[model samples]
Target: MSAKRICIEKDKKTSDDDKVQKVVINSLDYDSLAQIFMLLPVPERIDIEGVCVKWKEACQLSCLPKEINEIHLFFESLLDQKQTRSMRMHGSSYEASRELSAEVLYTIFCTCKNLKHLDIVHCRNDVAEIPLEKWISFQNLQYLAISCNMTPDLADTIVKYCKNLKHLRINNRHHIINTALKTLTELENLECLILLNCIKLNKESIIAISNNCKKLKRLEISIRSIYDPPSSLSDLDEISKLQYLEHLKLCIGKSLKDSTIIAIANNCKNLKSLEIAGCSAITETALVALTKLDNLQKLDVSFLHITDSFISKLKGLKELHCDFCEQLTEAGFIQLIKNNPDLKEISVLGTDSITIDLVIAADQATKHRTNGIILHIRKYDLELTQAFKSIIKSQWLVVK
Candidate 1:
């Protein structure tokens, strides 16, 4: 081959390589690249963080959807030694291999500037040691779910800094006293609050929340202590002030009375779902008051003093849970199904009087009205007949 021919061929090959590289680099603009990254699954997006400097920078951009603003910090080590080394090489201290430290959490908060929701679960008790002042920087946080024991000071800091917070779920098994709840009263814009197994929650704290956070729409409070008096009933007067409340679940001790239910029905007319489980003080009178609530769709009177007569009056009830109500009889159960044609789900578990025949009658009555119905009766009821057992096993029948 001639020298000129060989040189020309080499130049042509080099020119083609340059064109390919340029096309790949300039194919998508910065915003387009960030949008594509946002569409990727969590694991794939994390993978892109280690691809190169450009990808890691793209991941930090605010072009991602608001749904992805949530960050779940898991305490358990999930990364291998090799992965940890790679993260360090990329200058990222957010290690998945070791237990999350306060410094690492702060780094995450800084990187995710647009972070609105954060869930810190299965974290060590030492997490409380992290200064609340550090969290002041994350002022845009709108929702926070923490399983750790939060101190009054920390709670105060959260209410002070996270002014835009709308939803909060604190599953602290430790004693959460009134001081922390009083601090929460400062959050006037708070909408949804879920307090599960908070041992020290009392009437005073509940009243503070009710008086201050009038904008609250949904609330779920479950007190775990056995000795705490039913003082929460008196606090219901305070809760009655929240006319904007739509959904409420009170799984406290037997303090609720007819007046309490009447107060809720009269004031919170917007209430659509209500769960008063373990309120043994409630009776038929309360049910009569509840019947006035035209918007009430779901009712949970489990472990309460309710009978078949009271169940018949719930006109708009779509879901009724009367588990462990021994007074409910088969005749009344059938009457209930006939009366509330809109009823979609019914739970009569632990009721000894509900027989297989009654369930069959109830099912037949509602089957044609709607596509289907869900009945959660006692398991022993199914043992009376094989036909009933087969019906339960088949997908056609929905039982729990």
Candidate 2:
């Protein structure tokens, strides 16, 4: 054959191969293509739209699953796009730069209408940067977790827009006064509210929340600073009004007393999970008060001065953490375990009383039971006995 003829045939073959490749790529089903795109890393997923016209169309059609509820922008840089010459010259510290970042986040929120949980912890700009009037309301937003300097305006914006918000977590290092909390009372459907390091959250705010958010089922308030006055039992009386409260975690600065626990037990009969960890003021009297919560499933009384008798009363307890409890003895611990057969996990890591023998004995006693138990014990050196080490290796025990 002639050389010119061969060259023409080679070009024809190349064109045919390209056509076959395009046909194969386009043959993939929409769902399969969407799943493939969803499996890619966030940056790659965003870039997928630019791959080809077909891929771009598929990417747009791919609605994120409803179960993909959580949106975490905490660690990631909000300013991913290229900055203008002016923004670059001024640097990110400027208000304009932060506002630009906020706009990018606002775009993200606008896109994710199906998001039930949104966590924008440590995001540069305040949530208010996203104009409520222009954007669609987050009706499905149930859980909102923000860790920043909270203003009353931000609280009002959240309560105003996120009407269905059930769980709200605020971990602000700066003081959030009572007036800021008053805005949250408007969230009538609010079931769980967690306030950590908000020192200025006073009795009035607590009362406001109790009175308005009657549907609250879980409440966690942790006051880490001693500079703020301790919340007395009388101040916590407002919590009793939340009759439906089931899970309560109070890590106040040595303010939890017998009366506080008694009030909770008397009012919140539906209590299932109770955590009073680091409440050093609590003693046997508080434990007696806790016994009233017959349905209590999880209990964390770490660093409290409670005895074995306290554990014995919680017969239905499933998970218990008694770390750093110096008062709990080996016999008492063993007796507590034997009494609470329903116990699935127990942590006694910082206790000075628990011995290797007690752990081994408990394991042996409970091994016969159908569902096994997990015991978290204090860390020991390499010199630990082979028999005890074997138990740890078996995943039945955790040493830490």
Candidate 3:
């Protein structure tokens, strides 16, 4: 064959190979493919369903096998495309090989800057492969809830990075010290703070949070012992700073005394909802002081040895919980009906002394009207117990 013919044939072969390579490369550049969908002709795009097919293919490849990094990258890309406002990572126990818990959180926070609400519920307590402290800042953050096992250091790191945090729920059993507690002071916008089942929390920690977060509106805390009354009323006094407080839950440890609780109620007069669970030392006197807050809508004096006097003071109360109050008798229920005519929702689950007959009579007398009352009877009743259990359930929890 002649030299010119041979050259022309070689050029045609190379041109065909180039076209094949271009098609293969285009399939891999996902961003370009996404742009192509945006630029498609109206009629052709409608028939093609190009965007839907691409997303389905991407999601199947990324989320199907449960690859952590792939899922993370996919979410990041989606965030960039859609400008995601919130994200929740719940029970994503898809084999995270990370070492530091804080590190994994930091990476997520960094990638998702527009994230306003973040929920990491029931995650592994073990440290991720990476530490969280290295991450810079998350300026636009507002709400954060980290539940289950977590280190105190990670909590501190969060306080440092997420300064504008408004709502925080940390349910960790680790020991939280003063330094870590003080970190909350930096969060000026913090509105709601919940620390559930944190065994190591003490009075000092509460005091620090209250003192620092002056704009706080709601706070839920659990201490080491209810009886061990905090020598410093700093935390109690801090309530006055939060003039807008609406909900306050103090699950005192075994060390608190009657006075400690009274002091709290007396100070936070504007409180709308108060739950004093596990505060065994508190009595009727504290309840009387609580009634002073005429605005009190919901009160849970459960597990405390309260009597009829306490029940009478809460006349306008809405939701009342008296669970585990073994000392309460029929007199309390009778007084409740006679006095608190507005009493609506009530839970008297652990009060074994009150019979179902007495409860039914009270409910009937009340006419099951507005401000409904629910008498959650115990599982077992004595031989002399009233047979009104069936009636009570039918009237309140079931029908109403």
lDDT of each: 0.69, 0.69, 0.58
- All predictions: root-mean-square deviation over Cα? 9.5, 10.2, 10.0
Better of 2 and 3 by TM-score: 2
Model 1: residues with Cα > 4 Å off, grouped in runs: 1-68, 73-106, 225-233, 370-386, 389-397
Worst 10 residues of 1 by lDDT: 86-95
Per-residue lDDT over 1-400 for candidate 3, one digit per residue giving the tens place of the 0 to 100 score: 9999999999999999999987784566434443454464434433443345443232222221222221221233334322221122234422222111343344454454555555553444432233574434355567766554444576567767787789877766464454565666567789898777744555566567767777778988776542224565334545455556789887754455566556666676678898887767666765677777877888887888787767766766767788887877777777775566665566766666556556666657565555555433333444433455356533443111
As a whole number from 0 to 100, the lDDT of residue 8 in candidate 3 is 100
What are the TM-scores, per candidate, against the unseen true structure?
0.71, 0.72, 0.65
Cα lDDT tens digits for candidate 2, 177-290: 567789888898899998887555666776787789899999998885443365444666678788898899989856666677788888899999999988887778767877
TM-score of 1: 0.71
Candidate 3 lDDT score relative to the true structure: 0.58
**TM-score top scorer:** 2
Candidate 2 deviant stretches above 4 angstroms: 1-69, 74-103, 122-125, 132-136, 225-233, 372-387, 390-400
Estimate the overall C-alpha local distance difference test score of candidate 2.
0.69
